[model samples]
Target chain A: MNMVVCVKQVIDPEAPPASFKINQSDNTVVPPSGIPPVLSPFDENAIEAALQIKDAQGGKITAVSLGINLLRDVVKKPLSMGADDLILLEDEAFVNGDSLSTAYALAMAIKKIGEYDIIFCGRQAADWDAGQVGSGIAEILGLPCVTLAKKIDITNGKARIERVTADGYEVIEVSLPALITVSNEFGEPRYPTIKGIMAAKRKQPIVWKAADIESESSKLGATGRRTKLLKLFQPVREGECEIIEGESPEEAAVNLALKLREAKVI
Target chain B: MADYKGVMVYGESTDGKLAAITTELLGCGRKLADDLGQELYAVILGSDINGLAQEAIAFGADKVFTVDDPLLKDYQSDSYTPVMEKVVKEVMPEIILLGQTSLGRDLAPRLAFRLDTAVSMDCIDLSIDPESKLMLQTRSVYGGNAQATFTSESSPQIATVRAKTMSSMERDDSRKGEIITIEAGLDPSAIRTKVLEKVIEEVEGIKIEDAEVVVAGGRGIGSEEGFKQLGELAKILNGAVGASRPPCDNGWISDSSQVGLTGKIVSPNVYIAVAVSGASQHMSGCSGSKNIIAINRDPDANIFKASHYGVVGDWKKILPAFTSKVKELLDK
Candidate 1:
């Protein structure tokens, strides 16, 4: 089976966040300092899943991504993680495409690259946290898709899966050529091996553009995406906390309990 | 322009059972549905989910629209999105709602994408104009830095709501609703991704989301051993130990123990934030708490504003006393 995994580069979660002042005049986020970027946390789960399936099923894994020059690093990281090929759709024009647009680009790329049995992505990229891209791809491709998946198994040509739901969980099974966004527990992300790293150093990814992918420039970027970030400043907080006074540690503990009981937790 | 007159609710569950927010959204959905006279409809996706549809009515749904199939079972992006898109195309719902949990977070944007609509996620409050039926989704922006009102102009506008933001409806066994089963006619072959396993965190007792009392800690606990201090506080009080996004991000706490927008949006009756500075990102997740008590040496800490009660002091110095007091009260 052939598979495609989409990955994105994002600001490292550990990086210190810089505050943004809303541009009241424009109602937009005054861009903050760009922090060190890395592969989104969820994307790592996809890489892990792809590697596992490749190991078990003997299929080729294609690493697909859209970004800037940093695509080199992002593409290599997946190669190191065990993807057999890489397809990078990087350019300034592709930046800021909302889920619909992103999926459109991905679908175009998938079509350009021929057929595949499945597509994988992170549950949601840590940076955007929109969690929409994978499903958008599914919709555009008209494929079956599932998000927040913790478990996925490919046996006897069909895929069996498990995903987290609001109330509890579910066990599901489906045929492939599906798009799946992965959760952290989907599998343990693999570490780069010396051989794989060396192998990636010699490999170059195919980079596609909006024109190359045959997407109309109108539906290619801002025009294709639906939502707009009118404003991005942080929201205000409410209320002043009252410090409950207690006579001793034990007293404080008792006061705390009273607070809980008073609040109806117990 | 079309009138945004109707109220809509997204009915979803994890283990093939209805979630508390489904009831709450339904209860709230009913109120809005009643105000608009357009009717309250709950949307559910996944196969074999008909078994769980009854509870939606008990929470007050006039109708239930369900798309059931084996492909819909585990929430694949491929299978679920079209089903939702089909509903939006068929009903032209003025508004759509979902729980702000993991599933909700993943699905909401995808639905918004299919509808080619705008989305406001992690919202705490939702209000609709009685006459216009326009929905103003209220959510925390800039990491809880501010509270903002959001509106959508396109078709089937969507929003994902925080858990505990609305009260779950009381169950009424006598209630019932009309059921509409939609085939969605989704092709099984197009789905590319699949789930392989299910690993529940296996936590015991009430989840932090459902907890009535929460004992939270920040950096002031001072040591890895300090978590044991927080754990003691949690143990004596029969509550969960949570941390600000900072501590959890800093590797001082487990990711599951994280409390913030990306972590878990929770509201307990009483929330005690110890040694926490109350960053907006962390504070937004706690907006639902009935009462908040902040403890810190910084008198001007950000947490104080969002907290209902506070003690200005060292948490280490204050924690033992707080524990003893609670023990003493329980002993009494």
Candidate 2:
């Protein structure tokens, strides 16, 4: 069996405030730089979900990715962590496209590579937090797709999937050739090993483009997008902070509570 | 002006069952669709999913897009996106909506991308412009320290709304709607990522994200034991419990319990905040809540600004009153 897990690079969420740059013209965050990059925390969950499937079914797991940073370093993390193959969707055109473009690029590359039993994608991208790539890829390929999956099981050669619903859970059974969006609860991501890291340093990453996957240009870029940013301005902050002055913990607590009741927060 | 066909809500599903967010979205979507003089259309996709389509209409949809294909038995990203994309192209829906649950977070953006539409995530409120019927999407940005309202001029103006942010309407069994069938053209070789296995993690089960009511703790909880009181309150409410960053960082609660930009974003119907000092990161997570009751010792706690009700007193005293009130209401 074969499985492919998708991973993307994200800025360390805990980085110092100064690490990020904002383009004054727009409220959009300038992609963080000089900050250490790691596998998206959610992608780690996706990879972990894939690893569990590979471990149980005994298959070669391939890690597919798209980005502009050091491809080798990013590719090596998965290789070291246990992925059998790594494909990098590296190219300028694939980089800036929103969720649809990113997903198309990934699907295009995955199609070029060959056949696989299943594919896994993070529930959402941390930086953009748009969470659309997996479904976008599913749309492009016209396959069965499930999102927000909390658990996945394969029995008697069919996939038994459970996803979170509003009140409880929605359970479904699916066959092979499906796309799944992994939840943060899918599994705890694994860390790389010393030996795996050493071996990963020597592995190679295959790169692909939007053209490689067979998509039209108009549908691949900005034209394909229907949403427009009418205004991107920093949010206006109103109402200054109010201070409740008091002495003694009990008095302070009481004073706070009194004020809270007045504020209707109690 | 082209015919304002009204708005559409992408009622989400899993397996053959409907998700809570889907119902909630339909209820809210119904209001918007009605106001716009357009019929509410709820879309559900998955194999054998039509059995669950009735709930959409019960909540308020005028019509449903039902696709039951063997190929759609399981969720595949590549296969489903195209089906939805194709349907939207044919329907030319004015506004498309989804719940900001895990599924919505994943699929809405992809649908937006496929349709080349713009999307606003984690919206707390939705309203239709009386004049244009353009969706007025309200959401908290910059970690919930602030809130913004927007409108989409783009086709299929898309927005992923948060669950529990709006009260779900009572189900009307007498309501009626039509179910339209859809065919997803798919094949074996088309799906690249195959499912060899799926392993559900052993994390603490459904949390605030899925809870109807949530009791949240903040810094003023002081210590781990401070949050212990929340457990009693949560149990009584039959709701989940959550905390701010300080408590989690202080190890008062598990990291999973933290609510902020770094943690899970939740929007329950009733959010009870205790001893929390609301920072932007922490506020963002809780802001989506529908009915907020702030309970803090501090009069100036950031939570009070947006809370619907205020209790300015020791949680030790205020919580007991609140819980007892709920118990009384339940007994009646």
**Which candidate achieves the best DockQ against the true structure?**
1
Model 2 TM: 0.68
Tens digits of lDDT, candidate 1, B1-332: 36444567888775668877788888777766676667888888877886667878788887888887877766655567678888767766677888887667777876786666767777777777555466767766545554566566576768888777777778886897888887878887655555554455644556787777788888676665787787787777678878875565456666577777667777887788888887665776776788887878887777787777667777777777777767776777
The CAPRI classification for model 2 reads as incorrect
lDDT of 1 by residue, A23-128 (tens): 7776654544655467887798898887888888688989888877574765579998788888888877776776677778888888887878889988776655
The 10 consecutive residues of candidate 2 chain A with the worst lDDT sum are A225-234
TM values, all candidates: 0.75, 0.68
* TM-score of only chain B in every candidate structure: 0.92, 0.76
Report the lDDT tens digits of candidate 2 across residue range B1-332: 26436578886665556777778788788788778778888888776675677988888888888777887665555566678887787677788888776556656766776665668787778898778667888765544433556676567778988656776778887988898887776665656444433444233434667787788998888887878778776776678889987786567776567676646678888787888766666766776677676777777666777676656667776666556555554455
Docking class of 1: acceptable
Q: What is the interface RMSD of each candidate, in Å?
A: 4.8, 7.1
